[model samples]
Every structure is written in C-alpha cells, then in structure tokens.
Target: MRSPADPARLATLLEHRAHRLRRDASAQAEQAAQRDREAQTLRSAADKRLQAAQLGEEHGLDRQRLFERLRGVAIARAHVLECELRAGHLQEQAGDAREQEQQLRHAAAGNHSRARRLQAVGAHIDQKHRQARLRRQERQIQEEYTCR
Candidate 1:
C-alpha cells in the first residue's frame, strides 16, 4: 500500500491463512462424508442382491451361484468398509493438521506484528536521539555566537 509502514499487510496474511485452513478443513470433512456414503451405498446394494438371490433360490438352481456371488459381495463389502474407515481416519488427520497449521500461522502473524512494532519503536527512538543531538548542536552554536 501507499503506507508501507501500515499493519494491514500482516492482517491480510493472517486472513489468508485462516481462509486456507477453513477451506482445507471443509474439504476434508466433505471427502470423509462422501466416502462414508459410498460405503453405505455399496453395502445396501450388496444386501439387496443377496436378498433377491435368496428369494429366487426357492424356485430353481440359483443357490450355488448365488452363494458364490454373495461370498464375493461380502468380501467386497468388508474391503469397502475398511476403505471407508481409512478414509475417515485420513480426513480426521487432515483436520488435525489443518488445525495445527492454523495455530502456527496465527502465532507467526502475531510474532511478525510484534516484531514490526518493536522495529517501529526502535526507529522512533533513534529519530528522537538524532533530534536531541541536533538541538544540542544548535544550542552550542548559538552560545558561541552570543559570546563573540
């Protein structure tokens, strides 16, 4: 900005970090929900198939193949449930990491703001010292001229 000494830049950085953390956290949550939904859908579909097979087996030679298919579906369901659980865990981890990053970024921003304040204070002190020296020199000059 026009005022390079302004504190707005630090604010903007902190805002950006907060925004990113929220975005990432939401994304992780959504993905976890999606995976859970997928696993549930898969289980429902398999259950429906098994139910249909059981009903049809009363009519003819559907038992053997149906049993095999059901077995495979059971295996697939187990695998899908495992995958869903893993996805959920990963999402949780992502959320935790995002939280940690947010905390770190916030701390960094605060530290940065403090550092800038200290620098500004130092500069102001230095300026005052310079002005004091200038005033002393001017007084010495005036005294000598008056004596002459």
Candidate 2:
C-alpha cells in the first residue's frame, strides 16, 4: 500500500485539479463564443432596421406621412442601439470569463509540477533505504565469515 506521503498520491490529487481547471476553461470558451454570436446577431438586426427606414424614406409621401415615417424610423433606431449596447455588455462578460479560465489553467499546471517534484523526492528516499539495507547485509556476512 502506498503511504500518505507517496508521490503517486500527490500526483493523483494534482491531476484531478488539472482536470477541473481544464473543464472550467472549456466552459469559459463556450461562453465567449455565445457572446460573439449574440453580438453578430444584434448587428445584423440593426442593419436590417436601418435599411427598412431608408426604403421608407425613398417612397413619395405627403408631409404628414413623412413626419410619421420619421417617427417610426427614430423608434427603430433606438431599438437597434439598445440591442447593440446589450450585445457589447455580453461580449465584455465573455472576455472576463475567458481570463478567469486562463488563470485556473496556470494554477493547475503549477500543481502538476509540484506533484512531479514530490514523486522524485519519494523515489530518492526509497533508493537510499535500499542501499542501506544491502550494506548492512554485506557487513554481517563478512563478520560471520571472519569469525568462522
């Protein structure tokens, strides 16, 4: 059975942490992609609205109708602007998530390195113990043969 101080055990713990970090990073990346898509969708809707407003203006109309058309266009423009602002906020949130993910990844890597170092120390200790045991056995044999 491996002892509590075993390098393998420490490595296992570190690996688990690394896996969790990687998962988090993946989630953040997905969120970023979602935000980018939302921004694009908002921009497209705004363009469509602007095009419609221009087309409406192109049609010949009485002054009263023209004033009404302007009002409608103004409302559409406001809606478009609002959507664009919301999309921008989402994009910023996504960027923050991505940065958090990167930090987690770095932490996981550090843990992995620490685990490896611990394992090396454990191996070195084991080797020294084995050499001590062998030397003792050799000394005992020499003493017995000399006495005989």
Candidate 3:
C-alpha cells in the first residue's frame, strides 16, 4: 500500500498554491488599473467635448451648429459613463481576488505551522530512540565486564 503524504510535502503544496493565488491577484489588480486608466481617458475626452460645446455656445454659434455640438457632448458623456461602469466592475473583481488571495495565504500559513510542529515531534521521537539505544548499549557493556 502507498504511504500517505508527509506533512512537509503538504505544506510545500500549500505554499505553492498561495503563491499562485497571489500572482493571480496581482494580475487582477493590474487589469483593474488598466481599466481605471481607460475610464479616466474617456472622462477627459468627455470633459473636453463639453468645454468645446460650451465655448461654441458662448461664441454665438448658430442653432443648428450648437445642436450638433450638444449632441456630440451627450454621446461623449454616455461613453464616459459606460467606461466608468466597466472600471468600477473591474475594481470590484480585483478586490474580490485580493480577498481570496489573503484567505489562501492564511490557510497556507496554518499549514506551515502544523508542518513545523510535526517536524519537531518527529525529531523528539528520534532523539528518544537514540537515547534508549545508547542506554541499551551501555548496559550490555557492563554485563560483559561483570561476566568476564
């Protein structure tokens, strides 16, 4: 029959899983940042469009030209709103990923602590066995001397 996996090995696996989770979380954060940048760009574009429309109105643009500028401004604002929504969604996803990563790291730390405890226990048992063996050997030598 196959032997069960040792605690040290299990701890190593847990560490690896934690590392992977952290990497995934970092990627998620990067994606969220990218989305934020895109949203900001869209917002800037909308602001510029609104400013141009305002300027045109102040300069006494004809009614038809003013209407067209207003329409463009409206469309730009809508795109900005959509981009902002997507950015917000990405930020939420990133936060969730970070939370998951933290949970996994905690679990991994617990596993590592258990593994260390098990290792200490194993070492203690080995030390006792060694001491017992030495005592037996010393007793045998004494008996041999007495018999001689």
Candidate 4:
C-alpha cells in the first residue's frame, strides 16, 4: 500500500491530470477553429448570392422579364438571409468553444504549478534524508576508529 502523503505520487497524479486537461483544451480549440471556418464559408456564399442579385437588377429588361428577375432576386435574398442566420449561429458556437478552451487551459496551468511545487518539496525531503544517512555513516566510522 502506498502512503497517501507521498509527494512524488501526488506530483505524478497532478501532472497526468494537467496533461489530460491540456489535451482537452487543444481539442476544443480545434473545434472552435473548424466552426469559424464553416461560418466564413457560409458568409462567402451569402455574399456571392447578394452580388449576383445586384448584378441582375442593373440589367434593364421588359416588364415580364423584370418581374421574373425580381422574383429570383427575392428568392436569392431569402437564401442569403438564411445563410447569414446559420453563420451567426456557428459564430456563437465557436465563441462558446473558445471560452471553454480558455477555461481548460487555465485549469491545466494551475495543476501544472501544483505538480511542480510538489516535486520540489519531494526533492528537498530526499536531499534531507540523504544528508542524514551520510551523517550517521560518518559517526559510525568515527566510533569504530576510536574503538581501535
């Protein structure tokens, strides 16, 4: 059975936890980036559709053709609006993912700091133990020499 107060063991555990948190944060950041790219693509498509509609409007045509063109423009505008809404939703999701990633990163940093402190304490304890052992050995050697 391992002692619960073992600093080395506690440090290892904290280090592992920090690693996992960092991995999770990296994954979240990737997800946020993907969402941003998708949103940009949607916005690009919407812009293209709006431009086409504008170009169609600048052309003069007969009444019947004009009405047909207006209908097409209205449909295109509706599609653009829909695209904008979807892009907005994606942007919102990306923002949320970014926020989550930041939080995870912060938590990971805190855990890493704790692990480092624990490791330092463990090293100090080991050094003290080694010094004590050396002192004991030196005292024993001195006593043996005196006995001789």
Candidate 5:
C-alpha cells in the first residue's frame, strides 16, 4: 500500500496542473478580447468610410468617376470589415474551446481526488474491522481459559 503522503503529493500535482490550465485559459480569453476590440475598431472605421462614400456619391451627379471611386472604397471597406470580424470570431471560438478544456480538466481532478478519498476511507474501515476481529478472538480465548 502506498504511504498516506502519496495522495497529498498527487493532490498537489493536480492542483498545479489545474492552475496552469486556468492561467492558459485566462490568457486565451484576454487575447480574444483584444481581438474583439480590434475588430470593433475596424468595423467602426469601415462604417465611417461607407457613410462618407454614400454622401459623396449622392452629392454630385456629374462626377461619375468620383461616384465609382467612392463605391469601390465602400466595397473595400466592407471586405476588410468582414475579415476583421471573422478574425475576432475565430479567436473567440478558440478561447471558448480552451476554457471548456480547462473546465473539463478541473472536473477530472475533482473526480480523481474524490475517488481516492473514498478508496482511502474503505481501506481504513477494512483495517478497523480486522483489528476488531483480532480483539474479539483474544477476548474469547481468555474467557475459555478462565471457564476451564
């Protein structure tokens, strides 16, 4: 049988693992948030460009080339905005997945610790039973010798 200290060591190791997982998960979340903020800024810039383009297109009917240029600018901005949003969404998904993995790891540690505790309790009970039986046998021997 392993020493009582084994479980404590295992628990400490598991705790360290859990802490690392949590730290990594938090870092991923922070990175995702940064990406989201960046995407929002890009989206805002695209919206402004689109608004400016629309205004310029509506202001002058004679400037056909200017209107075309504005339309092109709006389209380019829209594409860039989509790309930024996609990056943010992908990063968010990655972060969420990492967090979920961390949660699973934490649950696994809890389960393992609980199972170990139960096993230790069972072993303790068995030891107590054996000692009780030995005591009973000694008492029976004494009683029999005295009766004789």
Candidate 6:
C-alpha cells in the first residue's frame, strides 16, 4: 500500500540509523580495548607483587615486613580483579553495540530491497499507462480516417 518513494525514504532513515549504530559500536570497541589493556597492566603488576610476596614468605622475612608485603600483594590483586571486571563489562557493552549495528544493517537492507521492488512496480504501471494512451490515439486516428 506504500507509495514508490516511501520505501526509499524509509531505507534512507534505516541506513542512517545503521551508520550511527556502527559508529557507536566502534567507539565502544575502542573503549573496551583500552580497558582490557589497563586490566592486563594491572594483572602484570599484581602477579609481580604476589611473586615477590611468596619469595619473601619462603625466606621467613621479618613478621611486620612480611605482613606489609602480603597486604600490598592483596591490594594489588584486588585492583587487578576490579580492572578485569571493568574490562569485561566494557567488552559486553561493545558486543551489545555491535549486535545492534548488525540488526540495523539488516533492517536497512530489507528497506532497500522493498524500495527496489516498489520502483519496479511503479515503472510497470507507468509503462501500461503509456501503452494505453498510444492505443487510444491510434483508435482516434483510425476513426477520423474512416469518417473522412
């Protein structure tokens, strides 16, 4: 029931939305990557501190110093865990954005396909109208000749 141009307009709107989603997805992915890098850095630092704490423990270091090193290791490990959690959350957000982009793209493709079909139908209708006009003109010319 839609006009030939309707689908085209709808397609344009859908394509714009798809483009926006893709841009958002790209931004989200970049943020996720940065978060992941930070998480890795935190994890590396935590691992080194933990390893040092373990070595110190084996050496039976002074009780106070040992407890302080252990506490430092614990704090570093907690920071690493927190960073990892944030990275995971950011990755999930990126994934969601990408999924939305894909959905928008699919909708845009469907609208474009519909627009093409509508245009084809409109062309056929115009051709039929032109043919009918030519037939009427021929009939009028034949009648005039016969009457003359």
Query: Candidates' TM-scores?
Result: 0.56, 0.80, 0.69, 0.84, 0.53, 0.62
Q: Residues 30-53, candidate 1, lDDT per residue (tens digit)?
A: 655665566567566656655554
Off by over 4 Å in 5: 1-5, 56-148
**Which regions of candidate 1 fall more than 4 Å away from where they truly are?**
1-61, 146-148
Give the total clashing residue pairs for model 5: 0
Cα RMSD of predicted structure 5? 5.9
Candidate 6 TM-score versus the reference: 0.62
Backbone clashes under 3 angstroms, per model: 0, 0, 0, 0, 0, 0
lDDT score for residue 96 of model 3: 73
Candidate 6 local lDDT, 1-148, one digit each (tens): 4465554455566556656655665665566567566656766775676565553425657889778877877776776677667666766665675566566556656655665675566667777779999999999999999999
RMSD of every prediction: 7.1, 2.6, 3.8, 2.5, 5.9, 4.6
| Candidate with more favorable, higher lDDT: 1 or 6 | 6
Model 4 lDDT vs. the true structure?
0.91
- Score residue 40 of candidate 5 by CA lDDT: 70
Give Cα-based local distance difference scores for all models. 0.62, 0.83, 0.66, 0.91, 0.68, 0.66
| Candidate that would win on TM-score | 4
| TM-score, cand. 3 vs. native | 0.69
Query: Native-vs-model 1 lDDT?
Result: 0.62
Which window of ten consecutive residues has the lowest lDDT sum in model 6?
Answer: 49-58
lDDT of 2 by residue, 1-148 (tens): 5679677677778878878887888888888888889888988998898778863425578889888888888988898889889888988888898898788788878887887887788788778878998999999999999999
Q: How far is candidate 6 from the true structure (C-alpha RMSD, Å)?
A: 4.6
Residue clash pairs of candidate 1: none
- In model 2, where is the ten-residue run with the lowest total lDDT? 51-60
lDDT of 3 by residue, 39-94 (tens): 56766775676566553426767899878877877876776677667666766765
Candidate 4 positional error at 76, Å: 1.2
Error of 5 at 22 (Å): 1.5
lDDT of 5 by residue, 17-117 (tens): 65666666567666667766766776767667666655442544567877677678878677767867776686677667667766756765675666577
